[model samples]
Target: MTRISRRHFVVAASAAVACAAARPARAADTVRIGYIGDFNGASLAAVATDQGLWAAQGLQPDLKVFTNGPIQIQAFGSGSLDFGYVGPGALWLPASGRAKVIAINDLGQADRVIAQAGIRTMTELKGKKVGVPEGTSGDMLLRLALRKQGMSVNDVELIRMDPSTVVAAFASGQIDAAGIWYPLVSVIKERAPDMVELAKNADFFPEIAFPTAFVSRNDVADDRSLKVIAVLKKANAFRAANLDASIAVTSKFIGVAADKLATEAANSKFLTTAELEASAADGTAAGWLSTLNAMFKDFGRLPDPLDPKAYFRADLYQAG
Candidate 1:
């Protein structure tokens, strides 16, 4: 995914805060966001920003696009951002620090692993050289997949490469199998005629883990966060209600053609405002976090366990 910073923008910056709750945008409420460049399922921040929904929540947002989740998560820690989007990996790591999942974005069909023609299944991938970007969702997904097939990362030749380079490597036969996300996965198929899906994220992780959530820095002002949360809810609602426009925005956001995303958009799911808040209170998301943390530890990805209650907050926003 391409990450562009100069294109980062602010909306309705001059709007007054006097009636912020009643109206959108104000000079005083500006929330900087660290957004990862991804498909329609994971690009809600880009979609919402493009739709100017943040302004409707009485806040202006400075959107910094990132190529991956860890760098985006770093923005929140650096205090350069108030909120951001990330996969479960970044949220689970100890380094992320107090960032909590505010909303569950896409549910599935966002990440997968593809193999050369002869390799038809995850089991066939054993002894094969597999490629994944270290520390990214691809890496986590690959790890989960290997475990499911009663294999270990040690069972295959693990090649840590950037997603951008994975396709080329696969084409050159540097790796027999690789975990990747769309439209790169799409591109891999287009370029490598031999590329075939070996496994998808849903094959192992929970829908909760597949979620690309809006996570906020713990220190963000409550009033500002409430307003930003309102925007996130509204934007999520807008996505379901005005999908065509949302897709158009997402296409530009991710620099992909709308037609390709249209197919993927149909496969994705968003955790509604009701669903997110309910999960927060019901301990569903928290439970998933605990399970995910444990899996990360079991896989040797994380050295220690993380507290789900401390990391997940369903109270961040109310339903629209």
Candidate 2:
């Protein structure tokens, strides 16, 4: 049997205790977290699972991991979620209706684009099928890329697919271009070394300094709002402070290679409360919100502009 290091054993033992301690005290009191990215397959979930972030706040999380924001938002609207993460573009659904954004979550620059073999430029995608969840953040980035070249979603065949499915589709020759996040991004690039980066997140929505966050009203009313933030903040802090250890734990929890987590941790940008709020108040962020709303309207995803103010809850960050 392999002897685990003392640090690894300590962290692992602590994780077991934390998982047990984090259980919700009541059904109504449970803070349902709808994570809309590669949650199970990524480092964020590992941080939550191992570092006792949720346990520290007395939160009972109904954690729903997803591959795209639209599916996660659907869960949010149906009254099944308390808090979750979303891309900047998917903010329209909640902004127009009920769910609220509390912060700017992860800003992963390398999590943006991974070009497949045979595609050298955005112009090369004129007649190819590109995979992205329609009306989500990746979708927004895709639109921005197209517009730069005097094109639109109509210019290329858009395949509405979950981010998780993107890699498989590419492997099967179903998609010529894929927009995905870490681990998957790493996989695609490794598989197709000759592919070119058509665009990155910064290249498109430069104003979107980071990804968006959301929480249902029920969580707010239940007094579990601060608990959610506490969990995320603690996990984020742990990730920031102990990158290697966190990566090892995250690798086991997410079931991805440890090397991938190391790569992601090196490239991902996390936000402090001050940093998060500053971006929320940015005129540039507001403009991006407006543009996102317009795109949603044009795509028939939303009927009109969703007020950016309605969705953001800066007080939560301030309190934290």
Candidate 3:
């Protein structure tokens, strides 16, 4: 069968669902999971499916690849998905009572501020055109990075552009810099090798954690959620132990070249089962969510920051 690319799947999710329904009957223990088709924490869903890890857990995986978090959240609300991998941009969905954050999949280290070789520090970005995809974690990172340097968006000529446009404009010299994440960051570096990284998501660290989470519907069964987490844990171990093999399978699943996918995957920092458990135990995960909440509110994207505990279900993760 011909494979569908992630871009195609985004526009034809409904049709894909219809096609899934027409396939031979699946096992009764089917689990409907949703994730963004990117090289972030959510990409593990593709690995799980490719490795039959879900089946090993007795789940007939009904995996839906989404273009973004909001669309995945919509699927969860419509009862089409039982669990979803949400990025930092939409972490507020759960805080708003729309879902429950069951696990912190990974800390986002894939985002970076890339600028012309001459621009070495965040403070130097003053008055320069910086491309940013507003409302994304990259945007938040840019704001925080600037703030850390006692600067703000007002210090820069912020040029709003989608990820793809940022790549093109940055490469063509239309923008002085861009706040973007991988694999687009990878793309930009390849297209403009002269560009230098000014800062990264990791630079903000504990002060501003950009984490991607595995979230579920508030009504999902505990047992099923536990099973999902178990399989994901196994998938994480597999990816860490067998990076090349993981990239080979994920490349086919994501429809990106193996080398490119490997580059993109290397940019992220996936948490181990131990790391995840520790973060939850130490209140680190909750702290991360709270930081994200405050960033959104500061940006005027949220009315008010909700308590992290309102959505972060550390209890569920512990039970797993």
Each candidate's number of clashing pairs is 2, 0, 0
Cand. 2 Cα-lDDT: 0.65
Q: Give the better candidate number (1 or 2) by TM-score.
A: 1
**Model 1: residues with Cα > 4 Å off, grouped in runs:** 1-26, 40-42, 94-98, 205-209
Candidate 2 colliding pairs: none
Residues 1-320, model 2: lDDT tens digits: 34568778888999999988997645434676766434322455468877666666666566777766666667766777656677666776665765776655666455454457666778878878889866666676677677778888788888888766887787667888866665667777676667666787667435544355555553365346766666666666666667788778866765678887666556566665455556655544455466667767766667876676656665665465
lDDT to native, each model: 0.71, 0.65, 0.80
Clashing pairs in 1: 25-55, 25-58
TM-scores, in order shown? 0.83, 0.78, 0.80
- Candidate 3 regions exceeding 4 Å error are 1-26, 77-80
In terms of lDDT, the best-performing candidate is 3
Q: Write the residue-wise lDDT of candidate 3 on 1-320 in tens digits.
A: 23567767765897888889899875658888887656674567877888778877778888777656666778887889898887787787787788989888787778888998788888889999999877677787788889889888999999987777898999999999888888777778888898998888778776777888888998998899888888877787777677788778777777777776777677777677778888888998888888888887876678776697877878778767
How well does candidate 1 match the true structure, expressed as C-alpha RMSD? 11.2
What tens digits encode model 1's per-residue C-alpha lDDT throughout 1-320?
A: 23443233222332433347667533656677777655643457766778777767767777777666666667767788777777655556532355666666656556787899878888888788898877777777788888778888899999988778897998888889887777777777777886787777666645436656677777866677677777777677777678888878888886888876776766566666667777767887767677767777787766776676666666665432
Candidate 2, poorest ten consecutive residues by summed lDDT: 36-45
Native-to-model Cα distance after best TM-score fit, residue 253 in candidate 1, in Å: 3.0
C-alpha lDDT of candidate 3 relative to the true structure: 0.80
